[model samples]
Target: MKYLLLLLPVFLFAKFASNESCKSCHPIIYEEFQKARHSHASLFKDPIHKAAWLISPDYKKKKYTCAKCHTPTDEKLLASFDYKQTIMPDINSTAQKDGVACAYCHRIKSIENNETQNINIISKKEHVYFGNLKDTIKNPFHKTANNKRFQNGNVCIGCHSHYRNKYGTNICSTNEHNELDSANCVSCHMPKVAGTPSNMKKRKQHAYHGFAGIHNDITMLSRYISVEILRGIDRFFIAINNLSPHALTLHPMRVMQLQVSVIRDKNVTNFKSKNFVRILGVDNNMTTPWKAKEIVKNTSIKGNEKRVSTYMYKLKKGDIVNIRIGYYLLSKKVAKSLGLQNNKKVNRFILLKQKVFIIKPNSFAPLQQ
Candidate 1:
C-alpha cells in the first residue's frame, strides 16, 4: 500500500520482534511498553471505544486527525490519509516504531527542494536528534542506524509552519530553508521542558506516546521572538502568552489549534468571506460570523514595544492584518469518540499579534522611526 506520511516522527529505529522478542533484552522497557498506550492506541475492537465514535460529529465514532498521532499502528492504515484509523500503533514504543515510524516523516521531503525525498532522506539523524541504536537485538520491523533527520528540527516542520494568504487558504509556507527566525517544529512544540528528562536514553524512554507539541505551557513561555529589521536592525519583539494555562490545554482526546494571519486591507473586508472575523473573548463560546472573514493564521508583535504580542499577524508600516485566537472544549462526546473522554483535558487556543513593518535589508531602523 502507498504509505501516507504523517508530520510526526515515530520511535527511534531498533530491531523488531513480537512482544516475546522484546522481552529478552529490554526487560524493563518491554514491561513499560507492554502496558504503554501502544497496545490499545488503535485497537478498534473495544466496545466502548467504538460506541464513542458513533456519537462523534466529525468522525461519527470513527477515526480523527488527532487520533492518527496518538494511535498509529500500521503505516498502511495511515498511508492513504484516511483520517479514520482507530488504532495507530505506538511507533515510539521502540526504535521499531521509530517514534512515529520510518514511514511518516520519510515520505515528506524538503518542501523547499521540490524533490521526492522519502524516509531514506528525512530519517537521517542530526545533532538536535542523534538517531542511533545504542544497541539492540535484530528485529525485522526494526533497525538501528544513524537516521540524520530522525530527531532534527526538520521532522516537525511539515505541520508546524502552516499559513494562509489574504484568503483562508491553507498554505504550507514553513520557514523551511529560511533560517532567519530559526523556527522549526521543536523550537515551538518541544522547546526544552525542564525536568522532562534530557539524556539520550531518557529521550528514548519518553518517546512512547509522550510526544510534545504546541500544547506545552511552560515550554512556550520560556521562548521569545526578538525581531530586528535591516533598515539597519530596528529591534522589535513580540510574545505569545499561551492562555491554555498548560502547554496545550489539559486533555487526552481534545482539540487545540492556533492560527495567525496578515491583514492588508480593512476596506477589503468581506464579512461574508471566511477570512474576515470579529474577535471573541474566552467567555463567548461561538465561532466567527459565517458572513465575516477572519484572519485566522499567525499573530503579530510590535517592534517598538519592550515586548508586544498580538493574536493576529502584525501589519507592516503600510501593511494591514488581524489576529484571532480559538479554543474548543473537547466535549465529552468528542473525547469519548477518541477514547479520551475520560481524559479531562480542556482544549485551549490562544493567539496574539502586533504590527510588522517591511524594512529594506541591512538597515537598522525604518527611516520614519
Candidate 2:
C-alpha cells in the first residue's frame, strides 16, 4: 500500500540512518554540522551540560527530561520519561552522540506551546522533511516540503525561546514579548556562507550549519551587536546596542561585562568594570536552577535594546579612552560552584567589541578609529 511504502523509509531511517549516512551526498554540510553546537548538545559530549545535569535534581532520579532538547535523537530516552519511568541514557548510542541530528530537526512540523516549556512536534509523515527552499528539489533519500517557519527562522523557538522551573520561577528567557516580529533568529545565527546546502545543487552560498553562538562562532554572531561612546563635559555615556531578536544573553549562567580604561602619558587608569547578569534566586538570595523561585536581579541587555551607562570620569584632551565589552560563558561565582573555576575557557573574558577613542581639543566627540 502507499501508506506502508511511505512508512517503510521512515522505519529504515529511524533505525539505520545516522549523520554519517548524509556524508556521501552532503559532505560539506555534514562537515560543517559536525562543528556545530547542536552536534555536541548531549551531556556526555558537552562539559557544561554534563556539569549542570550532574547537579540538577533530575540526576538523582535518573530522569533525563532534558534529553528532549539535549539529545532529541534519542526517542527511547524521551519515551521513558513520557511513560513516567526512570531510565539511564545510553551513553554510547548514536542518538546520544548525535544530539540534535539533521533528521530530527528537519522533521519538526510544529511547536506546541506550554507553560513549562515549548515542545517540538515531529512530522508524522516521517519520510518527508521541511526546508525553506523556494523550489522543491527531488532528493533520492526523502521528500522536501517548503516551510514558512524554517524560512523566517521561527522554527528555532521550540528550544531557544524560554524555560521555567517547576517552582514557577522563570529561569531563562530570550524574549520578554514572546513575539518573532522584533527579531529574526535564523538570519542572524544561520547567515549565508560560501557554499551550497547540499552537493545535489550548485549555489553561490548556503545557510551556515555551524549555528553561530557564544560557544561555536562568537565572532560571526558579534556582528549583530554594536557599541558607541558619547562624550560630555564631565561625563561620558557608553551604549551597547543589541541588534538581535533576543536578550544579549540567553542563559542565566552567562555574564556580560563592560570594561573602560584611560591611557594618559603611558599610564593606564582602569575604571570599575560593570557586569550584566540575570541572577535567579530562592527567597531573596541567589540560587541554582532547581531551587530558584524568582529573579533576584536582572541587569542584562534586552533584544534590540540600546543600553547606556553614564561615567562621571572627566576626560582631558589627548587622553586615549579604551572601551571593551566582553562576556563569559558562566559567571565566576557560578563557575566555582560548577567546578569550572579553573577552566580557562569558562573564565576567559571573551571580547565582543573594542574601541579606542582619543579626546580631541575643542571637539565634543573624541577621534575614534
Candidate 3:
C-alpha cells in the first residue's frame, strides 16, 4: 500500500489569485507587465524553455524542478498537484497564463537567506505587497511594505543567478548578482521612467516594469561591451571590457564570438576567431544540455572583467584589419538539436561592434610594391 501510495496522483488547490484579478485595480501596471518578457515566461510562449522541457524525460516524469522559476508558485501548494497527470496552471487557467504575474511577485515577503534560491514567499491571504519605496500609499487590494532588497539586484538572484540539475551539477550559473561590486540589476535592466505606477497616483519616477534583458533589444549588449585595438609589431591586441554589472552573456546557453578579418584590395580573409562559452554537460564529452556536470570552459567576460585577445599576423602596409564581435542567442548545434532553425526567438548573430584599423608601414620595414 505504501509503494502504491508513492505513485498516487496529487491534486493542487489554487492558493493564489490570478493577474486578471489585479488588472481591474492596477491597469497601468498590468499593461506594462504585458509588454515584458515575464508575461510570456510560461512554457506555452517561450520556445526555448518549451523545447528544453519537452525534450527532458524528467519533466515528463512529473519531477517539476523547472516549475520553480518558469511558473513559480507556492511550493507547498504545488506539492499537492501531480504535474504529469494534470496540466500546468499556466496552460490550464487564464489567470495563471500571465506568467510571473503580479500576485506571484508581490507575495514575496522577503528572502530567508543569502542563497540564490532561498526565496521566502508569503501565502496569498497575507495581501501584502513589497517594494523598494518606503513612502508608498495605501492600496485597497494589498498592504504596501518597504523591502530594501527589492531596490538592489539581489532580488533578481533567485531566478537569474543559478539552477542545478538532479546530479548535483549546476546546469546554469549566471552569477550576475555576485559578479559586480557596484550597480544592481534594477539599475540597468529596470531603469527609472517618469510615470506613476498607478493611474490614481501622481506622476513620479519609478522602475519600469518591462524588465528588459537578453530576450529584448541588443541595446544593453552594445552599451556594456567596449572594444579597443592596439597595434603591435606583427600582431594586434584586442581588448574587450565588460562595463555592465554582470557577465557579458548571463545565460549559460548563449554564446559570444569575436571575429577578426584581414581586408586587402577589397578582398576579405578570415584571420582568427575567439569563442566565449559557458561549458556545461553531464559527461566529459561536454555536449549535453541541461544535464551539465561541470563548467569546462567559461570564456565569458565577468562583471568589469577585461579580456585581451591577441592575433599574430604578417601584415602588409596596405592591409586593413577588421574586428567584429557578435552575440548569438544559441549555438548552431544547440539550435538544430532543439529544432529552432526558423524560430523567431532563435535570432542570428547580432553584430555588436565592428572596427577597421589600417596597418601603417614600419620605420624599419620597406613598403610592399
lDDT of each: 0.34, 0.80, 0.67
Sliding window of 10 residues with minimal summed lDDT for model 3 = 360-369
Of models 1 and 2, which has the larger TM-score? Answer: 2
Worst 10 residues of 1 by lDDT: 272-281
Ranking of models by lDDT: 2, 3, 1
Best candidate, lDDT-wise? 2
- Tell me which of candidates 1 and 3 scores higher on TM-score: 3
TM-score of 1: 0.36
- What is the C-alpha lDDT profile of model 2 across 242-265, one tens digit per residue? 887677766999999999998999
Question: Which segments of candidate 1 are over 4 A away from where they belong?
Answer: 1-73, 79-143, 147-152, 163-168, 171-344, 347-369
Candidate 1 lDDT over residue span 331-363, tens digit each:
344444446545444333323223344433343
What is candidate 2's TM-score against the reference? 0.92
Measured over all alpha carbons after superposition, the RMSD of each candidate to the real structure, in angstroms, is 14.3, 3.9, 6.6
| TM of each candidate vs. truth | 0.36, 0.92, 0.79
Clashes of each: 90, 0, 1
